[model samples]
Target: MGTTTNIIRVLFISILIDFLEFTIILPLLPKILTYYGRDTGINQDSLYVQTMSFVQFIQNLTGAPNDAKWNSVLFGGIIGSLFSFLQFFSSTLCGAASDRYGRKPMLLLSMIGISVSYGIWCVSFNLTIFMLARVIGGLSKANVAIILAIVSDSTTENERNRAMAWIGAAFSLGFIFGPLLGAFCSQWGIAYWPNSTMMFFIVPAVISLVLSLINIVFIIQCCPETLPIAKRDSKQTTITDISNKILPWHLFKFTAIHNVKSVDDIIILRRLGLASFLYMIIFAGLEFTITFLVYNRFNWNSMKQGKMFFIMGLCMALVQGGYVRRIPPGKEIIAAISSNIISHTNQDL
Candidate 1:
């Protein structure tokens, strides 16, 4: 196959899997809560807290605190903490593993892990089970890491921008389609309560599992390993003193080191990092908030949610496809961001 073909194929596969993961699960969450014994957000915007309290009441009465979804917030902090801890723990380690084990195994593991997580999600009556599933899922796979590693190993510096752009396109396409599919499956129990909509998670998990297996057995098998053994072993090269050696990934740290040649570089890097972090946090919260609103405030079914997301996706695609795409890379983008800040500042006035 041509390099271009391979690139497209890889990006398509990665984006497809990611879309399934994100969209399929999200739409059905409304239904998952259906069987939990309530319309939770009924007649009140403050029901978020009320739902948690009610879940707690059930917890004390049933003595199985985890069974109540809303109550997960009350004491699920420990589990949440553990989940975050594991995500941080696994991210770098998984990337390192790909460098050593070759990308295929690590990527395959991630898919399988997530599938199992969703499967557990389908029946997650207790918070502990959900937490465990997430933890295990987080640690299991690093497909993005592996795919990027493959691209790095295969493509030159110049070709990388286009390579990654295509990957991004695939991701966008996934976002465009995954929600609709999830929403479609969600209709299986739209008339029922949110909690009993277990099929939403289950069906997608089954689909993703099949897709992953197809990739693993067919597409992946056709793809050759990019990192040769000699290069891979470089990360684990032996000193006869095994006790003295540190792991490859464990060696990199972001601690303060006084080895900087330019304070300006430090400041610039800090600003960039801070901006990125803020953007990520804001975007995540906004997304979750929107999903919650659509699910609760409207009592919308999966297809509606899917259609809503589809229209949103179409707008986004147009924005990126046309002049707005320029806003990210050049003077235009900087100007646009600047204008936004000014508008926000004026709004505060």
Candidate 2:
């Protein structure tokens, strides 16, 4: 098949697989905790109830005295903002790493990080542990960026878009399935207290670990280095460029990376940055709204909340992946983030 076909294929598989892995937890946690088992435990169930209750209790006073809805929204925004900021930072370093160390190593390392993140979920004792897991996972969170870099290195310019699309599909699938799959696995036992919640993370983490190992042995080993022209060797960039070879990712960091290459470049980058910020803001809002909605409106136990999220995610994935054939990329798409180039021109330009 052609590059388009390949891109679609890879993105389809990657997103689906990842969705399966990630969505499993969204719809199961609440139910699994309370009433799923034949012989529910007095001790364990009580402990779990206390643990989740305490976590939410602590979360409430975490900031201003806003209503629970506002507080939850703020919390979700904080996490998204932090992760977005982190992406800017890690991208620079890891992209640089791809140049020095190679692509496969970074991919393997990132996968390992993901597995460990899920592993922590499996063993979570309380809210602190749960929050910490998200933090850790966020730090190592450059899967898409790193994969894009790998594809850029491996394929020609004409082929890069397709490669990227395939990767996008992988991401979509993961989002769709992660909660659902976690719910399915979490469904295994209802008698235990935290185990109900913990198992969801446990099974996925184990699977993630196995997947990482396979990636390390097979995929990473198989792909060849893409940065054929060494950073130091580029005649166009010059010796000054060699000494100043900063990794070129701008999404994750406040640290400037080789100040916008040109006026046009600056404009382009600024627009993208602002748009990304806004997108995250909205996404954070939606995520928090759903989380609290299930908690208060429905009085859903953890398992029920998980199930709700799973269904929501599945619908989103099917629509985006199955129907929305391809997402356009490049300056036009980037410009889409900034609805009005006129307003941001001063800042971007």
lDDT by candidate, in order shown: 0.57, 0.53
Candidate 2's TM-score reads 0.64
Best by TM-score: 1
Q: How does candidate 2 score on lDDT? A: 0.53
For model 1 the local lDDT of residue 33 reads: 43
Query: Model 2, 1-349: lDDT tens per residue?
Result: 3554543454345445544554454454333322222233563444434544544666666744545444444444454455556655565556566556666577567666766766776665554565566566666665556667656555666666555545655665566556555555555443444544445455655665555445445544444444554542233434443333343343333234554556677666666677677776666555544554566556765556666665655665564445333545545474444544533357421
Worst-scoring 10-residue span by lDDT in model 1: 241-250
Question: What would you estimate as the lDDT of candidate 1?
Answer: 0.57
For residues 1-349, what per-residue lDDT tens digits would candidate 1 score against the true structure?
Answer: 3865585576567656665565665555445444333334453224344446665776788686364333433333333344445655465566666767776677777767766766676566544455556677666545666677777777775565556655655666667777887777556543454665355556655665565556556435555677887777454534422212233222222222245678776666566556655665555544444554566557676788888777766655554444343444436547647645753465321
Q: At residue 154, what lDDT does model 2 achieve?
A: 55
Q: Identify the candidate with maximal lDDT.
A: 1
